[model samples]
Structure formats: C-alpha cells, structure tokens
Target chain A: MPPPAKIRIDLNSAVPAYRQIVDAVRVLLVEGALPPGSELPSVRRLAMDLGVHFNTVGEAYRELAAEGWLDLRHGRGATVIARGSPAARPEQLQEFRTRLRSLVAQMRSEGVAPARIAAELRSLTESLKP
Target chain B: MNSALFLSLLVVAFTGAFMLLVPHFSSPRYLFAVTVPAGFRASEPGRAAIRRYHWWVVRAIAASAVIVATMAQSWPDLAVVLAMLPAIAGVASFLRERSKLQGYAAPPPGVREADLAPDGDHLPRWIALALVPLALPLAAAAYLRAHWSEIPERFPVHWGAAGEPNRWAGKTPAAVYGPLLSGAGMMLFLLLLGLAIFYGSRRAPQRTAILKILVACVYFLGFIFTGVGLMPVVRVPIAAFLVATFLFAAAVIAWGYKIVTDPAQPVEATLDQYWYLGSIYCNPQDPAIFVQKRIGFGYTINFGNRMSWLLLGSFLAGMLGLVRVAR
Candidate 1:
C-alpha cells in the first residue's frame, strides 16, 4: 500500500490558508491519494504538523465534508466517503453549474480568453487523472 | 492603572484564554478525521492537485526550519519566538480552509450573483475584529512615546537577561545620536505606511504614485540616518542607527503592502500576496504541498524578521560597550 496521505501547505501562495487546505484535501480525494474509506489525520494533528491553527485544518475538513469527499464524525475525526465522484444532490448540481458559469464570467471580465479558460479547465481535469 | 498597561495586561490574558480554548474546541476534530482515497486507481487531475498541496506545505515548513536555525545562533531569543511562527501560519491556513469547506452549500441551478453575496455583511465585522489587535499595540506604543523617560531604558529587573548588565554610559557621544536618529526613522516609517494605506483605500489614480513616493521616502530616510552615523566622527552611533533603520524599513514595507491588496481575494496565493504575508518570511511554493493557489501574506513573517534584526543589532552594540569597559 502507498504511504498514508500527508497534507501539506505552502505559506507563500496567494490563496488563503484555509482555501489551500480545502484544495489540497480535494485533490487528495479526486486523485486517490486518500481512497474512499481512508481515514484522515485529526484536524488538530494535521494542524500541529503543518504548524497551522487547528481551526484552519478544521475548516479544510469541513469543506471536504460539504463536498462529500470526507465524512466527519463528532469524535472520530474525518474519514473518506466518496473518492472519485463527490455525490451530488440534484439541487447541488444546479447550484454548481450556476456558480461555475459566474466564475467563468468573472474570468472573462478580467480579460482571460475563452481558450485560456478552457486550457485551465483542461489542466484541472488532466491533473485528476489516475 | 495606566490605560496602556491595563490594555496590555488584557491582551496577555486574552491570548492565554485563546490558548486554553484551542484543545477544548479542537479535540473532537483531531480524534476523528477522514479523507477520500486518491484516484491512483484511475489517477485524475484532482489527485495531482492534492498531491501538489501536500508537497508545497512540506517545503514551506522545511524552509521555515532552516531560517529559524540559521538566525537562531545569532539571536537565540528571536529563534525561540520563530518556533511559534510556523504553527501560527499552519493553523491559520487550516482553519480558513475548514471554514470554506464547511460553508460550502453547492449552488442551486441558476443561482444568481445576488445569492453569492450574502445578506447582512459578515466581512465588515471580521475586519473590525482584526483591527482590535492593532489597537492594543498602538496604544501601548503611544503611551510609551508620550512618557518616553518613564518608559524605562531597561525592562523590569525580574525580566532581565542572564548576561552581565550593559548600562548606557552617562553622556556618551553614541548615546546622544543613537536615539535621536532611531526615533526619526521610526516616525518616518510610520508616516510612509500610513500614507500607503490611506492612499490605497481611495479610488484616485494618483494614489499609486503617492504610495510609491511614500515607500521611497521610508527607504531613503532609513539609510540617511544610518549613513549619518557611519561618518567617521559618528561611528559609535551608526551601529544603533542601523538597527533602527532595519526595523523602520521592515514595518513600512509590511504595512505598506497591506494597503494595496486585500487578502480576501480569490486567486492563487504566494506568501507575499496576503495582507498578512509579513507574518511568515519565506516563500510558500515548496514541493511538500503542491497545486495550491497563490499564497496570502501576513505581517507576522516580514515584521518578525525586522523586529528580530533590530534586537540583534542592539545586542551587538551592548556587547561592544562591554568590551570597551574591559579595555
């Protein structure tokens, strides 16, 4: 078996610390870094190791929970739920499309060409490949 | 009690309370954790993103360790303080991410822009809260300035360092010039930072030019004071002046940057991009955590370096004085 999934963060990124955590956890779930049913380090343990606030780690885990990538129990820490496909409720799917469209529009307003945006999406998909 | 002293005491007490609250609130989350398996089975782009973030985080921690170690030998006290640096940064990131994830309510189909902007703004309150910490520090500094002589040249006897006491020689040439120039540099630094922030908040196009000028003024005056002390006739004072200059430069740069960018933006992060970037000194793109967005900036990193360096310079001067006394 591959080594246990270790989540790390970059202090210098333009992303917010909590967002970075969410993104990192998301990537782990999508890439099979942590398979479905895999257990994650306690938010506190991860926070301590990463030298971040426990809240920051907790927030990341919460994000994953919302996305259905991880299951958080009251006293059990976080466990992997769905690995590759985040279970999407019908309402959630609709919301996702709306958010995605607005996000794209925001990019376009900022002068990003459609081709470039497409490339970014393509890159994101490619990165998810197992 | 003096208001500043009272405030300072209050801050210490609050910080202590915060520390205690940590484990109580975080224990459950720490005890049980979960993660989805990576797609090594079909390894997709999503997997790479997570892997990348992991790598980046590792690198950031490693670099922080090296910096702390290298600077420690020269400034042991500062080094110890630096130890807490990574922990603060890491935790901040963790909490932020967790909150975002928790707040995630998948957008409903055709969700409008109006929905994205939550009603009854939460951001303003948070910003106000952030400003609260600054108040205590500023109040204390202001009080000290108003009662400069009462501020005590040395800290209380109980808190004194382990080494031999280094008292300022009465009526020394260096002592006269050292404080004067250092004080001036401090004032200039504050002015520049204030200007940067003030200008940045406005919509005027000329604000950028004003910021550039303010920044330049800080750098220029800082060196000027140091250079004045370096003159053959003023060598003794030069050392102290340089220490002050370093501090002034760091503070201005840190606060100045905050005036320009709001860390609240959505984008990739670099350590320098966030308003808080000064909190952690090194770059955040290390390989331990990869595929992360741009890093946010924090004042702790950049300002910490300046504060540490200032103390170091002061210590060096004290040592030199002791050597002269022996001679």
Candidate 2:
C-alpha cells in the first residue's frame, strides 16, 4: 500500500502553528492528496507529533470541519469528507484578487521579472486544473 | 576463589566494558548526549573526549577490581558498592565531556512531520504474550495452597553467594505468598510501562523493540519468583537461578546494543537546552509525556510535563504497595 499523506510544519515560522496546519491540510485537500474517507490522526497524537499543545491541532481540525472538508467525531478522530464545490461569491473573488495582487507586488518588489512571475502564475494555474 | 569475589570481579568487568561502549550506542549525531552535527563524533574534540572518558572508566574499573578482590572476603556487603565505581566514574566523565561539547551543539531541528493516517497506534498482537506470564504466579499460588501441609514451618528467604541461607521466614501466609504476589505486581508494572512507552512516546521501531524486551523480562520475573515461592516445598538450586539470570541479562544487553546502534533507528530531535545533565529531559512545550533517551535504548519521561508527574507518582505508589505486600 502507498504510504499515507504527510504534513510538515515549521515551528519557527512567523505564522502560528494552527494557521500553518490549516493551510497545509487545505493544500493537500485541494490537491486530492487526502481523499474522502481518509482518516486523520487524533488531535492529541498530532499535537504530540508536532510538539504543540493539543488545542492547536484541535483548533485546526475544527476549522477544517467548518469548511466542510472534515468530520470530527467524539471518540473517533478526524476524517476527510467529500466537499461539494460551492459557487464562488463576488466578495470571495475580490478577496482572492486582493491577496494575489499583494503577493505579486511583493514578488516585484523583490526584483522578480514580470515575465518570470507570469510564467510561475501560469504553472500554478495549470497544476490546479483537473 | 570465593564465589562472591568472583561475581564482584565479573560485575566490575562487565560494567567497565558496558560503560566504555556507551558512547558508541547512541546516534552518531550525538556526542556525550549533546546533539551535534553529523560526523562530529569523528572530529578532533570528539575523539579527545571519548579517549579521556575511556581512560577514566578503565581506571575506575581497575580500582574497583582491586577493592572488590581485597575487600570481598572481609566485607562482602561492600562488594556491591565497589561494583558501582565504574558507572559512577563513567557518569562524571560523561558530564564533563558533555559540558565541553556544548560549544559544538547543533541547532535543534525546527520542522516537525506527521502522517495524517492514524493506523499504527495499535499494540502488537505479541503484547498479549505478556498476559501469559501473569498466570505463572497465579498457578504457583494455587499449588502452594494445595500443598500447604508440605511447606516447612521455616524456610530460607535470602541466600548468600555460597548458596547458604542468609535469612529465614516463618511459614505464615505473608511469608509463603509474598514472593508470588510481588512477582505478579512486578509483571503488571512492567506491562504498564510497556503500554506507556507504546502510547506515550513517538512512533519508532525502537519502541516496539523495547516493548518486546519488557515482555521477556515479565516472563523471566514470573519464573524466578515462582521458583522462590516454591523453595520451601521444593529444592531450588540458587546457582542455577543465578546462572539463568546472568544469561538472560547478557542476552538482553546484547540485543539492546544491536538495536540502539542500528543507524536506521530514528533519533528524536530535542532541544539541548531542555535536557539537563544530558540525560534528564524536561521540556514544558513538548506535548509528549515520554521522549526517546539519548543515553539509553528506551524512552524516558518528560519531567516537565504534568502528565509525567502523574505517571511518576502512580509508579512510586505502586512500588510502595509492592514493598508493603512483600513485607
């Protein structure tokens, strides 16, 4: 059998651990790495593995569950669920555009060429395609 | 040669050799329990520390052998203390070396990895074998009750190196049943320890290896103490017991050495600052109650964790209860 999907987090990163966990799991979910019906480690187990407080993993799992991606049971651990693709709202699209523009501005400020940035954007978009 | 003196010398030699090999048992990323860069153990400073540590251990062993040989006949009780010289000296040298190597301590790895799947948490089926030894003490207890008339009014409970009874116990209920009860208690304690290591520590191959050793030890304790309890009604050879114990211990140490020295064994990345004296691990931020030991083959409790205090407290209470039952 193939090995289970893994997630890595940098404890020294500027982002909070819960945010990092949420972002990493979201990426895996979108990339089809964590398929529906897949089980996630228990909050306590994941917290121990990450060397973080139990509440941190719990919070991340709660966020994912709220996003319709996970089902958290009392005794059983978190499990991935098949989430329906919701129609994008205009406000959500605007928020995404703002974030993307800010990221592109930062990249240009760091001396990235416009052509290189466009190429990188095209590669990511291609990867996101079904 | 006096058997006591011979045993003392044997212990000294074994301890000396074991202590000398201690530096090689741990991961190469660690020197004297302090985390170092890969291949640092072959560095000039690392070689010097190991050489000096060995020098002190050898001296301690020679001194212990002379003491045990000269003092065993006159003061057999002190022979046990003499046997500890190598370990005491080895620890002192190890700490000194660790302090010097602190300058070269590598940065603790900041990234942590974990699989989303939670499948490996179940205990191995062979762990059920630990339950099998629980019956030995129970069976001995049953046999003792049935053969009560055969038990003597007084029997040897302790023996000297010459196989002579050093202490006797009256054939009261406590005296007859204490050893069996204590053995059962010890077996239970070891089983609990094995469970704790399986559940409390991070997933690693060494965890299962240590658990297997614990299961074996539970079996060894069950047989040894059952034989002790039956000594009043049966002729049990003290020498045979000693030889068996020696062989069992030798096997355990050899197996443990092989597992700990395996390069593929994953070593936990713990901050050096959290480890006091390079042995006692204390990290409040770590959620794990047990962490892998840098100095030994098994897991050690994180003293800084609150749950660890509860475990330690319970263990001490259990030990006290065992002592009471034995008395």
Candidate 1 chain B: worst-modelled 10 consecutive residues by lDDT: B109-118
Against the true two-chain complex, what DockQ does each candidate achieve?
Answer: 0.02, 0.84
CAPRI-wise, candidate 2 is high
lDDT of 2 by residue, B292-316 (tens): 8888677899998999999999999
TM-score of chain A of 2: 0.92
Candidate 1 per-residue lDDT over residues B168-233, each given as its tens digit: 333333343453345343534444343423321212222343444454554455445344423322
lDDT of each: 0.43, 0.89
Residue B185 accuracy (lDDT) in model 2: 96
Per-prediction share of native contacts kept: 0.00, 0.89
